[model samples]
Target chain A: MPEIRVVNFSKHFGKVRAVDNVSFDVKDGEFVALLGPSGCGKTTTLLTLAGIYKPTSGEIYFDDQLMNNVPPKYRNISMVFQNYALYPHMTVFENIAFPLKAKKMSKEEIEKKVLEVTKKLMIDKLLDRKPMQISGGQQQRVALARALVKEPAVLLFDEPLSNLDAKLRMMMRAEIKKLQSDLGITSVYVTHDQAEAMTMASRIAVFSMGKLVQYGTPDEIYNEPKNMFVAAFIGNPPMNFMENFKVQSKDGELFATRGDIMVKLPPKAKEVKFEKTEGLVLGFRPEHCKIAKKEVENSIPANVYVLEPLGRDLIVNLKVKGVGGESELIKIFAEPGMNFEIEEKVYIIPDPEKLHLFDPETEETIL
Target chain B: MAELRLNFFQRNSSKISQAVMIIILVLITSPILLGYAWLILRSFSVDMVHGFIPTKLTLKNWRFLWQEMKGYPNIWRTFLNTFWIALWVMILEALITSMGGYALSRYDFPGRTSMLRFILVLHAFPSISLMVAIYYVLKVIGLLDNLWGIILLKASLEIPWGTWVMKGFYDGIPWELEWAGLVDGYGRFEVWRKIVIPLVKPGIAVTAIFAFLSGWSEFVFINTFIFSQNAWTLSKYVKGIIGDFRFADYGLLTAVGLFYVIPTIVFFFFVNKYMIKLTIGGVKG
Candidate 1:
């Protein structure tokens, strides 16, 4: 059963539409990430799910029960804020036990539950310490314990690891994933970090300019992006885009050409009708481009502009011929020990199966 | 000899700077301190006609004040009345301002921005401009010559400024802490009580001190609205001693002023730590 469903949710703030016509469902135990840059409405969407925000126009359901008018407390959800938001004056024990006390639980039961959560989070030693007395990482753990102690139906996290140092962030990410899996609770995590979203989410919903551009498993998002924005936003070095060339039919065989780079059309590419005067964008991931010693059938000769050594791999920036505009610059990842100097000419052959075509006007993928 | 010369050069410059600072400090504070001492000496002088500076010191003026003048009970009544009015005003001001400030700091409501602007304008208005209207209004309400009237007036006048100070303090408290309480299953009221109020205690102390000092030393409203001898406050009673030129009692008046100032000085000393805490907390939070 779907634990939470947002139906055509749209929230506007004055002249700005923060979340525009967003809709998604969370399965009973699935972990989903609303990933986007700041002001892309990821946090707004999480807040709406937490019931901190009432949608401008939409309906929400939790396990077949409508939650449109429900206040945050009655929604049976717990949220961890970006700042961790541990009560500064309260000891860890009190911070975790507060939710139980609110529910009128017996003092013994509250203590027991608080102790259990503290033990699980490995913060039992710091249970009596105030938040100010503990380190930030410890405080974050206490915040997580406080949220988990309630055993709510859903968990919402708003950039919970953004405040931690890189090493602690990685550690906490693993811990959060393990805890979510163990509890089997539906969770919606919000983060602007693409690496975090890719690593943590069962499926990711990529947002851009207050709209969900794509929602799928990480593999689909990385391999089969639906639009130019998603293709650029999801990858680290980003997909390199070059203008398309006009196709010429000779003896009923189609050939696409741009400068020295020309190739016969693949069976899949030949079936699509290329619109005249409608420009196309060709894209390929950096990792898919390779340096070949021999001239391959569809390889292009390019000059190496810059070489960046990333310890484990080399990022080779190439200047492709006749690609036009700033996108003539293409990135290629080479294995370590592949040495290249500036102005050195090389051959870059992109994998045919990995090539992506987009209609430049609409910015949508062609195939 | 060389080491001695170096020590002399370092020590001489520091000694001169220290001497200059001490001189400036004495120049600023000595007038008030010395005048107060002279008043004490004059109050105990044996001969009033010769003046207190050259005359033998005695308790004659004190005796005259206790036995001959009808002003003694008025002074005592005024002191008690001032104490009650200031005490009640301080309590009322602190409670109303802290709660209102907390709400304004932590909640979003309709007209919140306009309401804040209006309160700021009220705080900026000169209190003296309202004096005549306030007097006539008090007369119509029959609050003139009433003790509760003075308490209510002082509290109402102090609330806007006190609330402004408290609101700034509450604004400095991170909203995350309160939201944490809310997610921990506390309602809004519980969050205010358990988190917001405890965090702003130093602010409450600072606001209380301002309210208390203002109410304690207020003169114009208390004098205008209160005409009854039994309801007079300390400042009003002190003013009465100097009202008539024929029976002016400078020595007695100075002694009473010293008595009134002592409590404020003592109260300030007690809360000095809280004031420092308030400043540091404001910066950190």
Candidate 2:
């Protein structure tokens, strides 16, 4: 059995399914991120794993022992809540020493352990202050120190950096990633931030509508998404979608085209026969598409609908018509300092190796 | 201060409302202050010729009031009775509200909303209306004319408002704080003891103070339920000083009245800060 195994787990709140048949395995010493938009069941899944919630149906196992009936504290896991949840009445040292005191440790032992953990987190100076009296960044460190003091088998983080500002979040992200690896603890982090998950997690599990849609390494999830949902959700600016595309052969050349946008089929796709099909959806990432100065082979024509400059890069929103006479917008990233007027016609040459094709009816990737 | 600061009274230099507010404040406070002044003056008067003002100070009234009063026990004996009753009421009130308010604030169950409403409804009918039923119940329980009976009644009546104040305070505490304790290996009871109780100390102080004062000043229930002079509280003792009205000592009565107000005044001064800031959520009358 893996360090943690959740098999066919489901939690239903009356008529609503909060986490539906979610299943995943976390290896020993692995940091897995549960990532999704709000209300997508990521946090619900994390809570279930923490034993804070009892799954309505399914099995949870820790180190091969059944855990569905285990209370949170007995499960030998610690969770750092999103709000930090430091006791307002307790000093910082007491907050970190709480678990030890609960275990009936001697006063000197509790104090020694608290000092050791606080020193490690560099929050030793804040031992006498209350949570509210400390900076947000310092509070984050204290929350982590408190959670780590118990040295539980697994660590759970519920968007612990969500309350921090962008600069502090970034700094704490690096700190948490380093601390987790140094301790070699099996950790499950819940966050809706794609950037955070992509940067810190050893593996990613993407959830939507109470279901785990994809679970794999960051590289695999980003480069080889299993479905349109995973493809569109994993990247910044998201993957562009051209629905109801059809492969057509005009004068002995097979091309996947919708309205004025056209891309010649690769050698492998050239052999497949096609009538105009509604199930076909073409997908590619914004960073994978390049602007062709002149007509490049297998290129598609699109108008630059709008240009948004984001420091190092300019996102060119392309407007193109589909086969059904419906217009669509696709984002394309251009090198910084490149300028294009609105409505400027630009040819987009999507990287053949990076293009994604999906069957809309099944919502599964075809290539 | 730099942003065109207004005096506390007005930002646009309006003075009419401010003037009216001062007038109303004096109008409301003058009676209470003047009556207190008259009581203090009469307590010191050596003779009726002083006519609401004391010309010469005397300790005879204080001495007689503290040492002897007809139809009641000594001041120390009555003080003990009142002290025990108020202490019991305060402890019971604090215990009931902490649990009741925690449940109301943190959980949802069948009839929770109605229960919250129903507790306040218990206060809707006048105590006089319920007195007959309460009297019979006490008769059946063999608690009539018992000091414990009065203590129970006062504390029970206070649970509704005390619970509401407690619930308001609990509303401000994050549920995550409780959850952290649970995850820290503390049981639910331990969590309340270690986490919830300490954080809600101010709310508890307000509840205890109100309960103590209500018990201390209770009149009707004590007057009806307590028939023995030995069982009399400070309120009954004060009433006893006015018994029969023949050769009444206005100075003695005033001295006792001032003494009766001292404990409350001193008690309020201790907890006044917390009482002012309590959320004391709006409970429907």
Candidate 3:
């Protein structure tokens, strides 16, 4: 296994910056994923790491050795492309044996390793079948097996599970995570799918518009986002933001207010020194916003706009009357048994400890 | 009943249009087909000097050709010369075009776009226009009347078009396959040989067939450059019979033409699938 460190790497396709001064480190045996939307440069970063595209600037190091000038073949890496890219002319056995053959291993040894990998992937029965003859899931397994059979220093995946169907993608995600853990090989997977990154990666590097937005553990990224972008990006339904919120200290008590809908600020808010801006954006996840029957001390009155049942939970969209002229809509996760009619008046009390406050101008978290 | 009658009439009119289309196709194709058939028939007729519709039929022409082969070795010499030239051209064309095409498809070198544009522009220049210049150049280089001269000229002439065709075929193959091979410890050339070349076999086959035919049937260059009878190709040999007014052996000429077409017909039969694949996958797709 090799520890890969990308140091100030940047790739420019003409004027378009595909990867912009991105740097990260993958510890030996670590499974890291580069996650972002399409055109967010995650795949480009992975391709650069694989040495498919030479960086426009900066250096990459494998362990202590500089690798910017090294060719891909000399880098001792294996890559599984998004399309699987199995040789259409070769059978599964041949595809898996290709790397070993390239290394000039004995035929008997190649066959033994091929059989071992195919068995581990449960694709031994498909050894003789071409890529087109196999199912998508089987093809994915073959791709993984081919990459693993080489026993390279680092394994790179470019959205390897993006082409599979949803159910199969889930299964393969778990399988890939398990495989990485079992082999203890350094792997870097690139995907636009947040759930895939959350489920499969030991650490996720979130990218946006060719910039590394955040790099942290899934739990840290989800629960304690550093910026408004991370807060909006990490959650499935996304976080709701209310602008022009003010924090005031009145009668030795802390309260955050937007018009008349004011709630007592958590103890942590007192520690933050607010800037001169009058408007602060209050952020809360859908799950943290609770629906209550009666107005409590910190509850805000809202009218239910739409009720969406999501099997075990309900997403209730509520429009709250604001201090400003217009009303703002927010989603609250309700219990499965809870039922509310459209346009019905209700009150919502956000969990203060879970509330995220951001500077409206910069969109960076205030606390 | 009236509606059903109208529907039947429409269906019959459609069938008649289809027949008319087939008749038009035949009308366009029959001249070439009939010409080939007449040549084959005349080759075997005893009185082919008059016309292809000979009153008497015999294998006199065939027997005379066989007799001449034994004494002069003309037929064998010409056949060997043409085959040798075509073989060299085929090998050179496939190797040069495949490598050039692969480079053009994969690499991002300086001046690549201008080079590709230059090649495309070169393709637009008719080969006939270059015949005189090529002949003079070959003579200056002491290659006149030499088999290698013709082979070299033919292979060079075929490269631009062949490279264009194969480059398009290479473009259709995903770069990821080569990338996978590269990351798996194969160098660029090894990736091309083991991954890229195998994927574009149909393109190479197409280039080979076209190159072979171009070299095989070329008359203007072969007839102009070759002065000696020994260095004469099949086309030059065939032209000789047509040139002599005193003994214009039409039957022998026809027989030789038929013999020459046999290889081409066999070649097309084997590579027709690849040709279709090239047009379908390389061009339209």
TM values, all candidates: 0.90, 0.91, 0.93
lDDT of each residue in B61-156, candidate 2, tens digit only: 888545665545888888889989999999999999989899899888899999888878876757877888999988999999999999898888
**TM-score (second chain) of model 2:** 0.86
* Local accuracy of candidate 3 as per-residue lDDT tens digits, A76-114: 888988899899888889999999998899999999999
Q: What is the DockQ of each candidate?
A: 0.57, 0.50, 0.58
Best by lDDT: 3
Q: Where is the poorest 10-residue window by lDDT in model 2 chain A?
A: A270-279
lDDT, candidate 3, equals: 0.86
How well docked is model 2, in DockQ terms? 0.50
- Give the top-scoring candidate (TM-score): 3
Using TM-score as the yardstick, the better of models 1 and 2 is 2
lDDT of 1 by residue, A159-190 (tens): 99999999999999999999999998899999
Model 2 Cα shift for residue A155 (angstroms): 0.4
Residue-level lDDT of model 1, residues B175-266, one tens digit each, is 77776666667777888888888878888988898888888998988777877778877787678878865477766766666667778889
lDDT per model vs. reference = 0.82, 0.85, 0.86
Candidate 2 interface RMSD to the true structure: 5.0
lDDT of 3 by residue, B17-90 (tens): 99999999999999999899898888877774455577678777766346674323368778889889989999
Q: Candidates sorted by TM-score, descending order?
A: 3, 2, 1
